[model samples]
Target chain A: MSYLAFQLKKVFKNKLTPVCLAILLLLMGTVLFMNVRTNPQFSLQAGAKSEIAYRQKEINRQQRLLKHDKQKSKTEVYHDTKAAIKQNQDAVKQDKQVQKAANKGNWRKAYTIMWQQKKQEQTISSNGQDLAGINSRINVEKKLQFFNYLHHEPLPYESQDMPVTGWQFLLQLNQQYLPYVFTLVALFLLTLLLTDSYHQKLDTAQLLPLEKNNLMISNTIAGIVLTLGSFLAINLVLFIVASLIYGTGSLAFPYIVGQYTGGRPLIECISTGSFIIKVIVLQVLTFIFEVVLVQFLARIFRDKLPALLIAILLVPGLNIATMIVEPLRKICAWLPMTYLNAVDIVSGNLGMNYQNVQLNYTSGLLTLCCSILIITIMILLSSYIKYKE
Target chain B: MLTVQNLSLKTRQPILHDFSYQFAPGQFYQIAAENGSGKTSFLRAVTDLIPASSGKVLLDGKPYAKNKRKLFFFESNEWLNVNLTSLDYLKFVKRQWHSNVDLDQELDLLGVREYVKVPIKKYSLGMKQKLIVAMYLVSGAEYYLMDEITNGLDEESRAILYERLNNEVTQRNKCIILTSHYSSEIKVNNLHRLVLHKQKMHEVKQ
Candidate 1:
């Protein structure tokens, strides 16, 4: 067997490999169970009921204003009171239409009513008369565009429904949890694999007739293969299980990629499949970055526990730091950990959260690649200098 | 030939100060030293495993780094990754050294065939020792820098190992430098033994 194969065998044979895999599989199973119990399906009737409730509250407030505020203009108060009451009555009538259509399983008609109401809201908000602010206007516009898209190309499953098939389950897992899970698992596996030699008090391979650099490169390749390979394998297993249980869901399901802050466009979207592909690409880069980072830490500390602990803690620490510290948030475009949220980054949510328009998928891709290159060069240089001396 | 020039190694205090030695092929040399006289440190330093306080080690008149394939130094069984099978380690060393030695034959000769597939963690001390020796033999290196390799071996295993070392040196013209606390345990022909004292090597018997 080649050295790399040998290294991989060592990692595979490690007692920790099975333990990590078991934990990950268990977590996936729990997620699957929870998804079954709680459904996130969007209900037009439920939405209309909430809208009616909101309008009723507004009518009550206006009535109270007319009764208590004698100092104000009576005509203005009366006008506000009449408008609020009319709006509440209109909401009640709309709620009845939604309930009647929903009772007949006519979701399309209910959706139409909901969409027309949103269109009106969008018009009023755009006209600057909604009084909710620009963000509210953008939100209404986004929903209107989404409603139009869904009407034209409806999905077999509602876009917001709890994942019903393997594809959706994988997509959901990738979007909601896998970014952090992938990085952390990679961190744990790579750290343990690379630092095993140190913990052993000796690495028999280091005594082989190979250059230190060659050994390091072999180790790094092994670490990447084992960690990333495990991730893909686990994903495949979960996908298969979920797919068998629920027929594979549509790839054409729409995913809103957040409000398009770049221009005056309402919001952007792509097929859920496409969004998932982008996530995988960014995540692969992030994994490579993590493997190198772990190796770098192992080299620095030269102790297994310290290296592993630091690597495990570093991701969450940097993630929290970028979020809580305003200065850090502003500079997060260059911070590699900011991209660990590959789903958020690709979906444009991370960019929105950081308040930095530059933290998108493309920027994250570049940042991760650059970080890998820089750390790799540093590792090679340090190895060269140490051996040279 | 392997040559050491002005080698000084220190840890906590100086161990070997300005020590020098030259080792030639087709000979077996025993390195004898007191408990704290840096015998193991010297072997490690020669292979550049542990850095010397000063000086350089050369193989065939070139630096050791350039001639790594020509030298084999399996420091101790403690270096073994107990999670792996013995065969895994044997194959790794063989690949790294690019050796043509038959691994099955080596395993059989070392009598590790019975537990060759078992992980090192399940092996006895003597079994682990035998696997380490098997790694060295499979490497096919010209210079062997072994440290107390006979520690956990039974008398029969030691005899088999001594016979193998004799053939490598006399027939293959290989050079062997090993350290042992009990010199009486090694019975080989024309063994050149040296004692390490006062941070310098003194030839005791040839």
Candidate 2:
């Protein structure tokens, strides 16, 4: 085997490393499965039923109004004022129920009911415009209904709830778990890289035919490979577990969003290929950052504990600093840990208008290019310094 | 063959000044000095492990920078990763050297074959030292630069290493430059000794 391959094999053969990686994968899978399972969109017991009931009520009211108006308008003038009043009453009753649900802290039920009622109104009025008298009546009726719901509904359980898109779920997982994995794995590998040499008395590695720079290059390659392997393994395990608990293929984007978001028309977010690309990019970038950090630490300390500590301390502080300092934050955005958190590039919160910035295929390609450049530079410098001695 | 010309090194102060040395093929040279006499520094400088304030090391008439793999340096502490077994360690060296040597034979020679599959961390200091020598032998470099080679070895292990080095020099015609406190054990085979004193290298014959 080539030296690089040999190094990678050595890294993988270690029992603890793979075991730790497997455990991490299991944990991530459990979290993702739980996130999918508890999602309000997938809950057949609550949101779906309320939505259907609300729509049926709205449809019944509209049909009653239509029947009353038709009966009155058999001859010359179509005077259906009584029919319109009954329609308004039905709308008012639906609005009151929504208000009651909201006030009772059943925000999911309220939102679903309100959404269904709005949808029913739109569908009923799709044919043509009503007279001024009828239009005014409907308008006043909707306003009063809305008012009653808002005022009377017990402000339903402050459902800080938004539909969870697949990308969002992955993003959340990355934010909470990726850094921990990256930090731990990087430190573990780096420690073994630096201290193991001393412990094994293999100082001859430094004296090998390879330049100090190349040796460092070898280490960096080893580190990147190990980190990537562990990361993939963890995610794969999570994918399997998610598939099992949520039903087969539920871990896939279309099904995942369908389960959580009730297969809403706006579920387009999870179905796009761009979402998967974003996730992969985020993972690659984070892995690169960890590799670079480990390389730098290994070169500087030449021992495991100090290097590990420095890495641990630096990541959190850098994250906080990136948040507080604007220019620095942009720089940090390029950092793996920071990039991991900022993967919601489409979320529009990073102060850059993603649309205006033309963040599409070209930008993604540029980011990949930039990542390669930074990683190359870091590996070169690290190897140069590390192998120097 | 290895040559060092006008090599000077300093760390916060001058360690060696205008030091020069030459070792021919099949030569076993000893670098002897008192504590802080720049013996290790000279070896490091020659190996390009440390930056020499001024000088150049030549291996086979080419500058050391031109051919790094041909020259191997061994420090007192073996820098193997502790998690690796003896076999794994040999495998790493073998990969670097691209050699097909029987590692089991080498391990047996060093008396470490029994621990071949055991992690290096479990080895005693003497065992670790022997393993270092085994690694240097396996590296197959043209020039071997070993610093404090016999620091932690027991008598038996030391004897085994001495016999191996002697055999390599005589049989394979490899050049070896080593430093050691055990001057008596190394005073054999017309060894050329370089004594470091007053910031200079002085030649001595034994």
- State each model's CA lDDT, in order: 0.79, 0.61
| Candidate 1 lDDT over residue span A1-389, tens digit each | 77778778888888888888888889987898777665443355556667777777887887787777656656776777777778777867877787787678776666677678788888778777543566688678667766666556655434354674777788778767776776677787787788766633433445566677777788878977887788898889888887787667777766777734664433666787888889889888888888889888887787777887898777757886777888998889888888877777887776765567787888888899999999999888877876776
Q: What class would a CAPRI assessor give candidate 2's docking?
A: acceptable
What TM-score does candidate 2 get on C-alpha atoms?
Answer: 0.71
Instruction: In model 1, state the lDDT of residue B59.
Output: 98
Q: What is the TM-score of each predicted model, taking all chains together?
A: 0.89, 0.71
What share of the reference contacts survives in each candidate? 0.61, 0.57
Docking quality (DockQ) for each candidate:
0.56, 0.40
- Model 1 Cα displacement at A274 (Å)? 1.8
Q: Candidate 2, residues A16-114: lDDT per residue as tens digits? A: 787777677667666665665567554322543465566566667656665766866664334454455566566656666666665566755665656
Candidate 2 residue lDDT tens string, B33-143: 898878877877776666788887788888776677676776665455566677776777777776666666787887877777888778888778878888787778777
lDDT of 2 at A255: 14
Q: In model 1, what is the error at residue A214, expressed in angstroms?
A: 3.6
